[model samples]
Target: MAVNKVKKVFGCSECGTEFPRWQGQCSGCKAWNSISELRVSSSPQVTRNDKLSGFSGMLESKIRKLSEIEIEELPRLDSSFDELNRVLGGGFVAGSAVLIGGNPGAGKSTLLLQVACNLSLNETILYVTGEESLQQVAMRADRLNLPKKKLNILSETSINKICDISNQLRPKLIIIDSIQVMYLDDLTSSPGSISQVRESASALTQYAKKNNVIIIMVGHVTKDGSIAGPKVLEHCIDASIMLDISDDSRFRILRSHKNRFGAINELGIFAMTEKGMKEVRNPSAIFLTNKNNNTEGSVISVLWEGTRSLLIELQALVDTSASSIPKRISVGLDQNRLNLMIAILHKHGNIQIYDQDVYVNVVGGVKVSETSIDLCLILALVSSLKNKSLPENLVVFGEVGLGGEIRPVSYGQERVREAFKHGFDIAMMPKANLQKNKPDGLKIIYVDKIEDALSKLIDIIS
Candidate 1:
């Protein structure tokens, strides 16, 4: 009698590379102990005699005419957080899979739990946790002061078990605490391995689509602030949001990077409290500092957070330094952008502070990526260099070009209106941005060049 020998294949957990045999180091990611036995597949795994049938049968495909199709609004479940609603583009769409990634202690779990409790009022919610026990979740619920509601809690990591229970219950919404710790038992890799994460996500996506259940999955982030596991995980989900906190800031920003159903790059603001994550109603107000005081190196810029307009203060400090090479330190604003603006000021505005150490920070740690704040940044640098304090009730926003020309930005009128609502009396913007329909009760000051801006706002006219 002849005996059959089993052959095993190994896979890299770090980079999802597969190997026919085990290796000490992963050839893909070069990480030690990251490679592990994946599975044992017999050479004659599937015999011709064995018929592949059953399953859910085959799926039918169809196509429809654009004019014949009826348009209807997608149903969304309210998460009870307006800020979250904004970032999610109205609310959590039914049957949509949302993968939220964040660092540990960044409130990814807390935010999801909070939303789960809120949704349990009208919808049945299943909260699954692979990393924590039932008792641990209960303790957190108590700490959060959550009501004893119809929300179901399950502490299992097996993807098969999760799917079975989720399908049976058919809950309106399902919240998975963290997807990294989930795995399919059939796979030989660890829970956090790349294969496990990918398979688990695929299962969740299928479950949501087939059952019409909204699934919210929490994902751990890498040290670089990117979602853990394969980059494909983000693409697999209907929407992906990230929770990020800046160093020495109490505020956390919920930013949506991928959304198939709605807008992308939408933002939500939240503040961490002892109770739980509290959504900030007026996020722009939180970014303002010492509004009454007129300080040098401090200037306000209008920022567009999605469709909403926000007034953010940019603070800069410029002083003579002993070092031959002047230092440029920028936080929450692009360093390259600041450098270009500084060079623009030198060549165009004839305002030179190249030999001085400069530091620019976006107040309250709110990251501003739009080029609309360029003129405001240059103004802050000019104020710092000239030791001039801008008027306390002034708001400035415009795109500054390399030729020292100020350009128009989108939604300029809305920016001015938001600034005025926040008690900003004076609005300084590009002349091109001042359209026919302007807001009332706001002092409008238009300028075309960097020199014009400086001469109009500050005493440094030379």
Candidate 2:
């Protein structure tokens, strides 16, 4: 019998720490119960015959200087959906890996499957699903009623088999239903574990790059809505798309969390229908509803989401509270910002919010992080409390500070243009943003303070 040589190997899978032998705890990384053992091969690893033959073989595989490398820039392939194409900076690039992550039932699969069906013109697409069965995908395809020509579906969980299929099919585009369910036979780790996800993603990414195939991987998210699995999985992808689901099921928004080839903060809006997802051409109209007339505590604000412009409804309500501590609740808008705006109202405008419950919300179930909606929210709260209404066809947008100054928001011109396009007769914005040459046929009301804006709207307020 051959002599067996036992080797002691220690490593922490999470922190990548190596030790002399397996320990209950990893001292280098301070992680308990993370150390694992791996058998070391006694024989030297095999090398290619060319490497054994030395210098001439080395010359053939010599590293090229950076200057000698050809720097050709390849363009991305345009998808049939203009919104998706625009967000991806003109289209999906060959051999690029993309990660799409979102909450459960956030339509990540639906969106990607729609793209596959729409873009299957003359290009072969391989849709591999580990989570769903072949029957489930078939049902979805039947519902979509897509043409049955170029799209192929494979329900697989084995990484090795998937790669083998990819090699045999040589698809132009490949989509993995999810990264969590994929497993490798060589790895001892179970599927969806950190190690398994990382290894599977690395293997798929390497294969895609080598074959010049566009690959999109759907990823499951944590409870906090972040992508599940190790952070390394995200780092390996070329771009990341985050789909946001609102309380209202009518609208779904797609935002780029990371993009190596395109602008970062781009937003795409889609309306979910019985016939899959449909792009919303004019999102402003959908955002601004109940358009018969304007009421108290309602103000229109133009918000910029990347290159697109959206008109948002800012609504606030102030009522007397029965308890000692007034309830302050804000949805889709920051609660701290609402408090600060109330403080400014108390100090500058002599309006008291103490001992009162304040509720603020952005309409259409959309969240607004920008400070530009500050002035509009404050004015809306005041108007609602006083039981007064602003102008019916007027829009307001500006940032409010603790000092009661109205700051100019970015893309003020775009905001005004969007408002005008939506048939608003007048726009109230920061005085600092007034230009010498403004657009024709639109009234501009400039205000330096929140109180100044209120003064201009007093005609309708009374």
Candidate 3:
């Protein structure tokens, strides 16, 4: 008989990489001062096999050809919100684990509660709250006017008891109000610790996959807006979704960072209302609200997100620098990319803003990550420097290369059509993106080089 023993190890909170002892820097994530100690008991081999069997559902393993396996289509549970479905790559898949992270007041709970109420109408659903009490959840549900008759509520922090209750209930969907507070009895580490978080998430994910249950776990975010806990928690889940509050507190954006069933970097827009979270069907229109016509340094660009296109405004401000080292500040845009765009404008467009305080922003607090906005940003900077406003109804989008060539972006036709639907009169883009038949009311201006685009802009503005 072997005696149980305890061992101490260190792990990185950011990446969940383990080390034999303490280290100043985590080699896995390269994070400094993030290493923490964890004590874990050496359980018997039988205990390990029991957990493994719960995941694999097999006592013995055999090898077979991949082609010999048959494929089956698993139906998804629609959350009744189109935006949420789109971000989730259609809907919640069976036997899938999804992690939703957000700041405290970002409305993560409200969104999930709304979804759970809607989903409970058709299927058996279990709502487990470890952070909030049952009465608190019930009050919120009543305040939101959500249907609560069908949903089953449970308040538990122990993973073992949760699984036990799940076994009896056999709910099709189980929602963990939060993962950080959940603990496993076998682990000596406290809840929310690195060891507890990683193991709890792993166990839940395995249980989800093995039992063909859809489990959506709410996770807390760090100050930096990243999901709190070991990075392995994200890896074990089928999808990692984040809910963020826009610059306008009234709106929220749901983004999918990883998805096994659908596209990555997908975005879903929502509005916080008195009743609950409402999906923003037309995000472009909402983002372009309250526009001041003929404003210098302001331009509209067509951005392609996930499977759709959006018309977003880009604004730039160029002023004489007061300090020797000019400030290069950007809001809702990458700082390094701003620097690169400035360099491109200087070398290719022949505009020198190196001495000026350059500030760029995407209107409406929408963070634009695609490179398609490069030309729009640079042109906005030029418009600001010269104090000449671009056309009020013009939409511009194209990538700028180091060699000064205007490169076409993906889904150019879709972008053009989206812009045209919004009543944009002029569309300035790369020549390569020139379609055979332009929209009825939209004029297409195709430019081959950065200078050509500027010259054509002069032609249009004149």
Candidate 4:
């Protein structure tokens, strides 16, 4: 009989790429000093890997033609929260493993508890909390006035025991309070280690698929906002959603980073209250408030978020630089893109602000990522530079190219309709976005070049 030997290898914590030896840098993710040691067996014998192959006994992999495969629509489990469902692209798919990550005190537990309570009424749900004790969870549920009769709660850190109980209970969903604290007894390393976290998540995901159960795992994020643990943890899960909240705000933004079952980059809004997390159904209304008293730099723009259209307020401030080098700061927007937009303003719009400091902000703490906000941002910059306040009823959105041409963005018609519905009187956009069947009462200004837009702004402001 041949003896089984152990092989020590190095792995990148950022990307989970394995290496034969330790190195200062990870070649996979190009991260500095992220390589860590990992040990595995080099045995020829069939082990747990064979069990997780998702095959039955005496059966081998078979090749099937794509035309022969049957396509069936699977019924999704509704969490009863419209905001969450919207972000999830409908509902949670059966047998899918979802990872929700957030900073500490971002209402991750509160949100999940509320969801589990609402979902427990219809189906069997298991909430396994490894970080908190049963009493703590119970106290929170009671304080939040949530239904607790049907929800099964388990305080376990051992993944094996959790799986054993789950197998017997045969729940429709399993909620792991956190994956970092979960550990396998077979592994000698401590819990929260890279190996433990990766293995534990993999095992839970495999179990979810094999048993047709939904597993929702809560993950902690590092200071840089990336999920804690090997990046492979994200790759193995079906969906990775993030709950974001600022220190001074009570609002929480739930967005998807990865989703195999639905659309990605979907945004959901919620407000944390004394009772629990309440869904913000009309997020656009909440974000568009108090615009009547608009300032010199304030501008309203429409953002295409996931499947819906959102009206956002953009504010920019330009002032003389106090330091030798002017500061270009942006909040709730991309900093690098702010610099590029400033350069475009100088070259195309003929508004030079190289020596002045520029600051831009998106109201309501919503991050604007779409390029459609480019025209709106440029207009806001010009408005601030000239100390001119744009009309509160005017909405602007279009992409500005380096050559000073205003480009059309996606879903222009929908954006225009959303602006019109919000009582905006004027819409400044690219000529390409002009609709044959325009909104009835609103005025649409089609500007093809940056100079034309500046002139229009002057006309509207004057």
Candidate 5:
């Protein structure tokens, strides 16, 4: 056994900031008692091997001109799931590192296993887990009814050891069930510390690019819905994807925040079932319910998520408030935006809601943050306060400005087609978004101002 030199260090628990010495408050985040003393290994550092990946094996280094350089697009390894592929910007690009962060029991492992199995039909994949045993992963695979292939699974945590195995196998793709628990053998800090998480991810990323292997690493999110590790982990990754699940466990939304090759804010819909995650082909049907289409306080809204348009229902309930200042409550929608929309309704639509307790929700627990849903949100609030139901098939989507102007949104044609496919007859949208060729089944009701849309809705409801 080697003697590991240990030194006293101070680290912030809240933001994972390291301090040279102990202090009452963390200077980085300004939190009390957030700093704690830690014993970290100081010496016997894990140095990089230049010859490991031919970085030092090449002779005569010479700078080449941009035109002389050969550019080759890396091949994509399809996971066979279009939802995953689309979110990943087509597929897992060779020699790229993709990081996935999610809450516990959010189907991170299940989705990775499913992907590995799907790709194993033609390529090599290694699924490594530091938190679970081989038997546990095997049981999960069995429960998901995953078809057995050449997919390999390993129960390990040592970063060096896992890298050695990866190099030996030269797998086309590798997955670290989690990067948080993985630690370098020479790092003094324990696994999950700020240093360990950051260093381990850096090493893994370098290995992926050097070996031409795709690395998919799992990460856990903090309380504020951010990756728990150091902020640099996200910066170092080729793509940063998050999987969010609602309380009811009906569907999971996969969102890509950072992608080197694909578009950002790309969304993928999945339904959690006994057989693992199933892709939601049509999100409109899942988010909108026509059963209570005629009910008061329910307004149909079309939201553009990624390249798809989702038809969702905004339900608002209004009642007398006991307090002078009414409480503004919202779910799956920004409270601040809701408040702004309510203020606009009172100012422009002559709908006074200052003393009423307003509660708004997006159906199916789906979150709608796009400005295009602002018009529908205000419509739902006004309809609830007046106790009237708008048209059954009326679909509203457009941004509402403080001056009562209806702003146009992108992908207007796609939103209209999505609404028409769902049997929606009339669409109340911004006048500027009206296309020359409209779908046969849908009637576009263009409104330039909030008052115009409100007048149209109030006429039908009254």
Candidate 6:
């Protein structure tokens, strides 16, 4: 009797690159330990299965001419959350796949659950949770003060079961608590594994597109802050929203990393309260503190996140260090850039920061990465070191160069408008940014160099 033989093939879980046998690393995608051993089926594997299937079906099926295909506009479903609607490009588009990612306890589930509850009256909503049990979800729903009716909950980890439920119920909107926890039984890999995440995401994406359903999948981030599992998961989705959690937990910032239907770099602010995540309508009011008087080491800067302008407080501390090597630490701002600015101060302004321990922070636990806040950071540091306070109701923003020249930043008009709306009386910015159609309410002051800005602020300080 002859014995049957079987062959195993190794492939990358991310890019689907196949190898003859099991390997320690994937050469195609340069991912470590991503090679998984898969049983090679008797049928030959086709490289272009998805393309061939889609294209061949299009050709063989009843051919509809371009003009013959019906053109219909689908209205977006209102999420009842203004900030979410704005980030989602005028609300959630039907048949769209949105991937929301954040750290643990960043309120990803809370945000989605609240949205589902809010839309329950008009549309049938399904909330699937793989990470949490039904009791856990129910407790949260109760805390949110959501009504029990019309909101369906399913605590399942199997992707097949979830899809089956989706088909049976045919909900208007579907929310998957997390993609990492969903698993396909056909795949031998464990849940949240690279292979499982990729395969599960692909299946759900296909199901969503075929059924014309709006699906929102929550994903976990890696230790390095990148989305966990395969990169193709992100590519297959329609939009990706990244949530940033502050140490204080009072505020959470939602930013759009990718949007096929809307603008990029859009930001949505939410406050984590007992009632769940509540939208912050007026961020400037909450962000702008210390209205009574101006103090040293604190300066207001108008920063633009997407189309919205936020008034942020930039605070710095410069003091003598006990150690031989003085420390340069920054929170919510780039440390390297802070060091470079200090170097420029030492070189051009005859100020020595090398012997001082410098620290910088953006107030309200918000992160400001734009270079427009550079001038404000420098001025705040200088004022703190000299024990001098800036003038009241004054805000400053500009990009500082190594040669001590001030460079213009984007969306100057929007920043100025926000400053004016926040009752800021004066604005100091780059001279190049002073253009036509200036904002009517505030006093716009432009400067060409760091020295010029300091000179103007010095008079007010005295």
Best by lDDT: 3
**Where in model 4 is the C-alpha error above 4 Å?**
1-9, 38-46, 49-60, 246-248, 290-292
Candidate 1: worst-modelled 10 consecutive residues by lDDT: 48-57
Best by TM-score: 3
Candidate 3 per-residue lDDT, tens place, 272-383, comes to 9999899999999998996789999999999988998888889999999999999999999999889998998889888898899998989877888889998998889989
Query: Higher TM-score: candidate 2 or 3?
Result: 3
In angstroms, what RMSD does candidate 3 have relative to the true structure?
1.8
TM-score of candidate 2 on Cα atoms, chains taken together: 0.84
Give the runs in model 1 whose Cα sits over 4 Å from its true position.
1-58, 61-71, 246-249, 289-292, 459-462
List TM-scores for all candidates, in order: 0.88, 0.84, 0.96, 0.94, 0.92, 0.86
lDDT of 6 by residue, 353-403 (tens): 788899888877777778998888888888888988887688999999999
Clashing residue pair totals per candidate (backbone < 3 A): 0, 0, 0, 0, 1, 0
Ranking of models by TM-score: 3, 4, 5, 1, 6, 2
- lDDT per residue for candidate 5 within 247-351, as digits (tens), equals 458789898999998988888989999999999888678776444857889988888777777888889999999998899999999999998998898899888
On the 0 to 100 scale, the lDDT of residue 388 in model 1 is 79
Compute the lDDT for candidate 2: 0.79
Candidate 4 lDDT, tens digit per residue, 343-405?
Answer: 888898788999999999998888888899999999999999999898888999999888889
Candidate 5: deviation at residue 219, Å? 1.0
Tell how far residue 294 is off in model 3, in angstroms: 1.3
- Give every collision pair in model 4: none
Clashing pairs in 1: none
Q: Candidate 6, 444: how far from true, in Å?
A: 2.1
